[model samples]
Target chain A: MSAAEDRLPPLRRSSGSVGRIALIVLGIVLALLLLVAPLAVIFAEAFSKGVAYYARNIVQADTLHAIWLTVLTAIVVVPVNIGFGIAAAWAVTKFRFPGKKLLIALIELPFSVSPIVAGVIYILLYGANGLLGPLLADHDIRLMFAVPGIFLVSLFVTSPFVAREIIPLMQSQGSDDEEAATSLGAGFWQTFFRVTLPNIKWALLYGAVLCNARVMGEFGAVSVVSGNVRGETNTLPLHIELLYHDYNAVGAFAAATTLTVLALVTLGIKTLIEAKGGGDPHRPRH
Target chain B: MAGALTARRVLPGFGPTMGLTLFYLSLVVLLPIVALALKTGEIGLARYLDIITGPRVLASFRVTVTAALLATAINAGIGLLLAWNLVRYDFPGKRLLDALIDLPFALPTAVAGIALTALFAPNGWFGAPLAAMGIKIAYTPLGIAIAMAFTSLPFVVRTVQPVLEDVRPEVEEAAASRGARAWQIFRKVIFPTILPAFIAGCTLAFARCLGEFGAVIFIAGNLPEQTEIAALLIFIRLEEYDYPAAAAIASTVLVAALVVLLLANWLQARSQRHSEKTP
Candidate 1:
């Protein structure tokens, strides 16, 4: 089979070199324009006002706070998602039971939700006129237009990444390893940590990387719940908006450059992990 | 052993883990959706109908749906071309090209919006050149489509790339040996293989475009009846404190999403079955 495949080569290999060259040129140019130029523009604009100005604006208290908030949100959100991802993946994959498919489908609903709709839904559930609004008010509690609200909305949008990555892999791997470990007298946690977790580590990291990228970039729902509280709830993306609106183009683009780097790092890690996974790596999503 | 375990739920913590998953899923996802449904319910059926049928809401829906459809269609073709190039050819920066395709997923939508708006604005890079030709982009519905197209292009490319990679050369050689033309081989052999991924990717792109807010808002000009998207209309209603109106629009989009989600699920299942049949 391998020898026959080698003999055949690929159809494209036999095509005219001129046609191939033209297609390659077009592909490269399009990719550069659509994918690469955006990063260049953000950096160019950021440093247009000079590096000192860009650096100064980036460290401004509110801008720093926005950066901090973005990181903090991801920090909290990623782990919770990691935990939920683990639990859900375990429940559905390791234990095949009634309603298993339904459970999997429901976990995916968060991905289907429009971020703005997530915010709107939260508002209906927690706004002053909402279902639990009165109850929250009675206790002098707040969840909307606050840090907690931002976190919750971020949680809703990002909860799916980790579980979606791990579950399918675990399902395909089956429970043989775990069953083997159990037979060998390992405790449940021991079997899980040694056998299951080690095997799925790359997928877990892959999912976490995507999750971190998203939680940081999340703008739509965060905008609704954040209320654009400068030095407060404004995450990096929202802060970039605030700067742009205030005509601080340099500041806005500078903040945007930071986010661009974050995205680049995420893409880097994602690529590296996928490379490590070697075989057909399961494609993770945004 | 496998049969015995399957028969009796041999796994430990099934109850606890399952409970936590259900509770979290319900609280984080299902409840909010349920609350939106309930909120829309209070507005009597006539008022509910009236809210969605309002001039502003109607206009927003048209812009959103039309722009999304156009974007998905555009991405479907371009994304396939890009994927085909990446998989079938050897080129420098090929890895970079592949990595960069995922930028849309990684980059913040707001950043994407501004980058696109800046690039297409009159004073911006591509904008200045296009302006000489009287081609306006930013602050236009065309700009909205571009942003939607940018954010969604990855879906089609990623989905189709793997399928393309898995298409063995031997399969194509068989057709070639039959004296088939390149185009015919592509149509008969290549196209059918990738069609399912293309459909799957297009659906995701369409669904995503429908909800796209940050990227679209920056470029769309938000010209209420002309350029505003459905998601923006929901945000606007909340800003105006018109809860019922927002919920009404939300109801329409949610219903649409559920349908699309269902369709996507069915497509995925069908594709899985197709692959198993052949492989």
Candidate 2:
């Protein structure tokens, strides 16, 4: 009886249906135009001058240096964040601890703080007159407006991704496998490498991919501390800004297109991993 | 035997874990926050109030929060529609469209700013048409709002999409079978389930827009009273070597963000409890 009732006739057509459809279509079209069209225009213009100009612009000394700096920052920020993620996940999931709730909130602090705030705090602590400034100068070490400053801010901005991803995965998996490994005479390190690491690897990778994207694309925080010293401190995003301001639209787009392609590639990898993980129940563990 | 052996081992538990967490937090997060608070403290409360309440800062606060709120509100409605369509409809290019939503997340903010500026400048493609109607976008508060909305749209869409997907269609079918109208079913059945997720998304987007800098600065033209956002104002202060003023402004944003985040977390917890009790 319920099955027959569920097959009731479809609703009658009304003028309101057209209006609703139109509204939804209009909203979607406007969003696509706003978000996708600008990038489209940039890509069109980049190729308008042929591949030679694109190649020349992207290979310029300053542009290349900026790209290198961006890559270096990603290299530094991603692995360290993954390590932090693993350790945090281990502590949070494997042990019942005091202040657990507070610690969880603290782990996500970077997510709530503005990138600009991250930059400001770094400046206040490491700039010429900052709290640690005098002490650092005494030791002849520099952080503000240097590579370390750039890396530090990037680290802060992308800090939450890995831990955020891995913690829940760890919690859901529980500690049965670790216990079994321990009973089999495995030490802490051995259990972690053999049992825990494999279970949370996908979450770890997902987090790393997300972290890399943010680190590569981060602008506000890096700009505040970078001093924008041309080849010396300009990352790819900063370089794009400077080039556009200098009326070098082609160069800016060339760099942007490169980053966009990188982003798409990472997103593809994430989708593939997620799909694979979904197909096999045990796959999420690895 | 296994239980006895496991119980016998001393796991280096809470003390080590808390110590490690605190050490990392202090080095990376708490210390910098303390420095910001300390710098603000140096300029007495009276002077700090003067800086925060000055005309320029006040204008920035009004503009940033107003634009963020407006954008987040718009996104909440539109993002829900988009999520609903994506989950319910079977259309060609659906996967492609879904992928495009994440473009803003992947695109660098500075590049986004530049691209938007080009598209909306007086001589640019779209600007040519809009300028005919005496509507200017680039280098205005309107342009700032548009940029903020563009970058922040994905946050709401992504947040609500999964929730919408999880709201099984069978309930809607059941409601319709009972002779309920479409709007009534949507209002009574679908709306309550997704409200918490929608609010969470809006809060995140609003917080993000308030702190946005790279995308706003290039298109805003950074005119002091007219288009300077709070984040850019902090940048200008730092550039002028006014650490105290910058700190004061930053602290204001920090406190505001914390309040919003706390409220959002509470709502999330409440929703979780509600679901647990019902389901």
Candidate 3:
């Protein structure tokens, strides 16, 4: 049923029923071509052999290691990003500040940056001939071509997710609740936990989900710093590339299937939260 | 500084939280971008320009810009239509289509790349039939554009959807009462409102397409100077241990991205100004 609020007066009647139908058809066709087809292709290509074969491809040592590393990266990166996102949002929205706009733009810098360049810059800082290369080498502290490198690049790529989500939500929410709680003699920690945290928890998880999604699926940046050392530094996306390059199309597709499933789970939860409608952080974006 | 002194909120943790936020932001985001710029600077102006403007690099730049433009153009039309439908019309599967629009945002880039390649590769499903018609998609500039279009599709739609949603139908009704036709009503009424957002969305999509590496590289077949994208070329430079060359080329993308981001921000600020004044 059309929303009565959205209904046009007879003067502004929609392009008749036929025009509406045409646009809906266009929308469906575009969605299928862009969204559904890619998803279907991944699933079909994965099962071109059989579920058993797909399982075998993913169960191998190298592939498993890639999966583990991807998850490990997310486990480290998501919380740190969550911390930064919360801190940034709290700082910008909860208090009066100067250069708040500049801070936000800086926080969102990675969003505009290419993953390839994001990787390269880290290399510039820590690679063999990088600025800290000598210091790192002397300490035998490996940053490039290691898990730390993967962790860092993923952090850069996803840094904005949680903060971007929380900032607008908090801005719109204002500091009213925190102020009230504080006036009632609530301490900083108490106000945060009792008054503020509950309000933004869903948004928090929402951002974490996005951060985790990007963490696992990040390719270009991680690929740059990873050196694609199979089973050592390869994340799931890099593992898929490795499989494809080795002419193991099935293996690649299988790995792709795993990441595809993760994407779906992320989408599922995001949709559920948005549907629940508790001050959805996604509202500002769309 | 004046605002901090004049405006007071009882909320605490600003100092601690903001301190951490600043420090972390510097470490991860600002510092890296600065490092990128600094590394490029260290190579000197003449050499950097030479490396960035070399024939192979120039050809890759041409391909990247052209493909990104093509993709952005396609997305502009389709995304406007998609946003219009989702906001104005309610239909069967509307929710599904609406949710799936975010799929590109969620899906791994490599997956989209390979999947598109599979669909358009010779001996594959769509590829075989298209090949019969002499329309080679895989491993061509068209293939790169297709991947670019797919990965960046959501930006235009998402950016415009909320703006479209906020527009009231009453304006269109008033226009129609004045004898405005459907097309005229949209052009004179609805289109003007969403124009800033549309431009913002298109620029965002264009920026994303410029930086896209995973999806396009898979489908483009990485034929340097023909279909090679700038991002992948930079990666290849890194692999060759030509760090100076990679940094120089990568900065061009950074510049493109910064321009687009500035456009988006300005458009956003304009829209926000409009929103604040609306009621």
What is the alpha-carbon interface RMSD for each candidate? Answer: 1.7, 4.9, 2.2
Best by lDDT: 1
* Each prediction's whole-model lDDT (CA): 0.87, 0.80, 0.86
lDDT tens digits, residue span B42-74, model 3: 999999889988999999999999999999999
Highest DockQ model number:
1
Candidate 3 global Cα RMSD? 3.1
**B220-252: candidate 1 lDDT, tens digit per residue:** 999889999999989988999999998999888
Task: List the TM values for chain B, per candidate.
Answer: 0.94, 0.92, 0.93
Highest TM-score model number: 1
Q: Which stretches of candidate 1 lie over 4 Å from their true place?
A: A1-10, A14-16, A278-284, B1-9
Per-residue lDDT for A195-247 in model 3, tens only? Answer: 98898998888888888898889999999999888889889999998899899
Indicate the worst ten consecutive residues by lDDT in candidate 3 chain A. A277-286
User: Candidate 2 at residue B25, lDDT?
Assistant: 70
What is the C-alpha lDDT profile of model 2 across B1-279, one tens digit per residue? 557754644333445655666677778888998999899899999999999999999999998998788778777777777777666554556676676676777677887887788788898778789999999999988888878887887777776776666676567778887888867877888789878877877887887788888778878877888888999999889999998889999999989989888987787677666556655
Off by over 4 Å in 2: A1-24, A278-286, B1-19, B168-170
